[model samples]
Target: MRRTRITAAIAAITVATAALTACGGGTATGNGGNKNPKTLTYWASNQGKNLDDDKQKLTPELQKFEKQTGIHVKLEVVGWPDLLNRILTAASSGQGPDVLNIGNTWSASLQATGALLPFDDGNLGAIGGKQRFVASALGSTGAAGKDPAAVPLYSLAYGLYYNKKLFKDAGIANPPATWSELIADGKKLTGGGKYGLAIEGANNAENIHHAYIFAKQHGGDFFDASGNPTFTSPGAVAGVKQFVDFMASDKITAAGDAEYAQNQSLEDFAKGKAGMLLWQAAGVQLAQRGMKADDWGIAPVPVQSGAPGQGTQVDTMVAGINLAVFKNTQNRDGALKFVKFMTSDEEQKILNGKYGSIPPVTSAQSDPQFSNPEQTVLRQGLAKSAVALPQVAKESQFEDVVGPALKDLFADAAAGRPVTEDSVRKRLEKAQQQMAG
Candidate 1:
């Protein structure tokens, strides 16, 4: 999300910053230097059920780092709502943590600031070569042909989650494998006060993620080669309309979903009010909320007609967090050491296991813990079918603008207003024009 979700991408600030241009090479600032080799600061994105959980879980690890490297670490867990804004403030002022976790979707946008240390061969080699990371996980780190602004840490991919009991009760034998089947199954599950699908209609990140997949599945992309917005393109409009139709026309999603900016959809699915959910690595959230492993099952998010593939058949967005270093950090060596420690196979297994995410490190992914059915579905999708959001300097702004356009459309759909090709196109046209201005 901007699935770091829709809650991520960025917190909507009315006077949003303008789009930035990618910088050609590494740039440094004077605010950071080698003045504090024995200490480092980190801004970790909120990955646990709450901020305290993150701190409690990470404290032991930081202690280990301090013991091993003699570096005292300062840790701050920033909520998704404020993470990007805080990072942006730090980047522009050259006053930020030594290291930070960024929503993978923001890689290129943050890269353009030139405030992050790009992992060129030397930097990458300092930790482990770029070869140590999963190839697909590497896809969203930054723009193509440029040194990555960050490296993969905790990786995730969306999958369809369905209640096993609901499927049985409805006499549905299997989860839907295509759009038609999904809608059909949805109808069977829609009665008795239960709907077939749960969605985060007002979530910008979730909206953009699904819209990106739907667009590509219909054989289109949001940006051109030069990274220009093409939101009104036929495939994009059709894609968005397809998403809205799930509620407006198909009647699978509840009308109230149009106002669900929080994780109400997941909660709804967990409580058995909805039969299915489309989400990224939902096992943790569901488990914490009291849904056991046997209660639900997971499958690849449906494709148009056939199995998911690397091309237009893509089904999920490459969603996760990236570990990055600020270019001018005082303790560059200490920060890099911390990165290596975090991405280490042992740590990857421990950390990703705790967070219910797939390890981006190839070796760690082979651990038996991740071999479960749910992990298999998510790992396979991330490796074979998921597509990264456009890696552009304006990618963050795109989410800020286009995400709301869909939000409004979803609102209209919930209000019993018509959702049409023309309406979707007009909204997209406005979104694109905003990009231009």
Candidate 2:
């Protein structure tokens, strides 16, 4: 999942610094016109089971880089909770790692700060040209057809995970292929204190990702071509209502599940308390939680069937992290070298394999491991129907505003209170107003 921890306060801080002059163009020249710096610092995001795990896996790669480039390197693995705040502070102060990893969802937002070096034509050519990367992954780095501020390093896509045993017990021969069928299957599976679906209602990022998929399935988008917010569009409203109705209208999920975060929902599924869940490559976590390989199955998320002219299926957000170079670093050339090394096909294999995510490099994506039965469905969905979150400067604000509105609606639904389409529209309209301000 693309976890955007950006709160209103953080959004305000980013907005305040948006006007700062961007350090554009070529890498900074070395002292006295000499090139080749001796050292560089890299801020890596926490990708492994823990921070130490990340260090264990990356240290060897960094050593290889140092040996190849003669540049000493310092690596710091930042936890997700602190990474964004740390990057924002560094951007504003012009002090941070020479290179760093950023959530793909934040690419456009951070690019607007002028704190990162743009991977323009020259820089991209130095690495391997734009065509070397997957088109969908590259499309997420920044605004369309513009010089991207970052490059994709790893990739992930959501899948619908279900309990095979649960389906069999419910007399269902196959997983649901459409929303209506999912609800029907859910009704059959819900009973005897077990739920049919598990939702991360309290986690803002999780909620927004599902909301995005639902909106796209209904032929709606979060923003129009002109970058105007369209959260209250009929499609958006219908999508969100479908999400919230799991607790309200369907009654297939628990009323108290509005408090569920991503982990909690996963825990419920792992324990067999819930029959199905929508999650990203969580196979590692599921195994860690004591779930067996044969116990669960993965499939593409159900689409809105019978919608006029809509495609057969829609999947989750095109999710992953990107590597970016800070604009103010003195060792620009060294940092660029480091970025090239990290995204190299070899390094992509090592990092993505160890982390249980797909490599962004086209050649590396064909690895045998990625074709495991569990991942095959998700990879196919990504190739065909995975939608990237809207790449807008205000994307973070979109999360900050709509997340709580959805949360509140879920809370009310869970409490057996009244919820109407008008209420959903009002919440979305208020969010639009907030984005306008």
Candidate 3:
């Protein structure tokens, strides 16, 4: 996961200043008419290769969208670290793209600014109504109970990926289905400087995803249906205990793992230095290309204490980017059309197949590769048990706070310091107040 270069406080201040400078009220379009060769700007986050490679993957499809609608799209891909500043600056100044791909967590925050045009129009329903996509995927990209603030593009979900050979070597015939079993397996695998699990206590993104899985397993969450913070509940305590204990427990995660994030864990796992890891689907390719074929395989995350809902995990990156029309776009209709086309069933299938992402639409699951027996495990797991993270516009800030906050608590726990619900609650309460600001 990429770390923010600037502190959240400084970043927020900088973004606010930029937003203030960018503020303007103008017609969605300029005096120039939306005619023959209207160009629509679209900003997206950096994914593969560089802007060039992304453009290549999108050029043909974009051309199709433009040719069909008589509008050309100018693509701009920015790295995640700089994307927030760029969008806020452009949006406040009325200079953003006709359509933009924003991180799902930003939807609520950006939408709350009232700078985006809602697709309450017929365009959203025409491509695929809200019902066509996975409810959790759609929910994650929008204001949870409100009209969707953004359209879902592609999905990502995290799972426990294990070294198959390690399990076989330990005489573990079946994957661990519960926390108890996981610990037992960890004991069997740990030795010779090889730990059983690799977790990211330092990376905020990875921490949030891990927190979600743990909280869900213990039957707690970051927020209730009303969107209030609930991070100190008993379930949350259990979740945190399990997470911290796994890292501190002898023969499991190393005590020094607090300084390591997902990247370190991935490198360790890819190098076969760890027996198991929780990570995104992208790790599949990394492990396959980087490790022996028979060395590793993927599995649903383990459950808590052999309780019901075995092998459950919360899905992140399950949320897809929504292409919102900037209120300042000169071609709102064209932008809307392009948004519809980019998230259409055809385009979704193509992107998901090639990019290793889950399609935003439930029907897109029909694509044979996604529906295959091997892939079906994750698909069904998501469909049956997946919960979307809190979609409150303030979630990005929430992440900024809760990540470091948890790191502090988990680090202490790993170092043999007492960690109680009160300590966790105190930190979370402080974070909640900061986000409220």
Top TM-score model: 1
Tens-digit per-residue lDDT, 300-319, candidate 3: 66765443343344433354
Worst 10 residues of 1 by lDDT: 12-21
Q: What are the models' TM-scores?
A: 0.92, 0.88, 0.81
Per-candidate Cα lDDT values, in order, are 0.86, 0.80, 0.67
Worst 10 residues of 2 by lDDT: 25-34
Cα lDDT of model 2 by residue, 1-437, tens digit: 12244444455445444443343322333211213388787889987657897899899999999899899788899986578778877665555678899989888878777677899998898788888899889988987766898999988888889999999999989988788888998999899999999887787778889888888877777899977899999889888888888888898888767987547888899999899988878787788689998999987788877422224246678898999987666777888888899999889888887777888899888778888887687677667777788898778778777887889889989989877888888988887887776
> Which residue segments of model 3 deviate by more than 4 Å?
1-37, 49-60, 63-70, 126-128, 255-257, 287-295, 305-319, 410-423
Clashes of each: 4, 0, 8
Which residue pairs show collisions in model 2?
Answer: none
| Poorly placed runs, candidate 1 (over 4 Å) | 1-34
- Sorted by TM-score (best first), the order is 1, 2, 3
Instruction: State which candidate, 2 or 3, has the greater lDDT.
Output: 2
What ranking emerges by lDDT with the best candidate at the front? 1, 2, 3
- Give the winner by lDDT: 1 or 3: 1
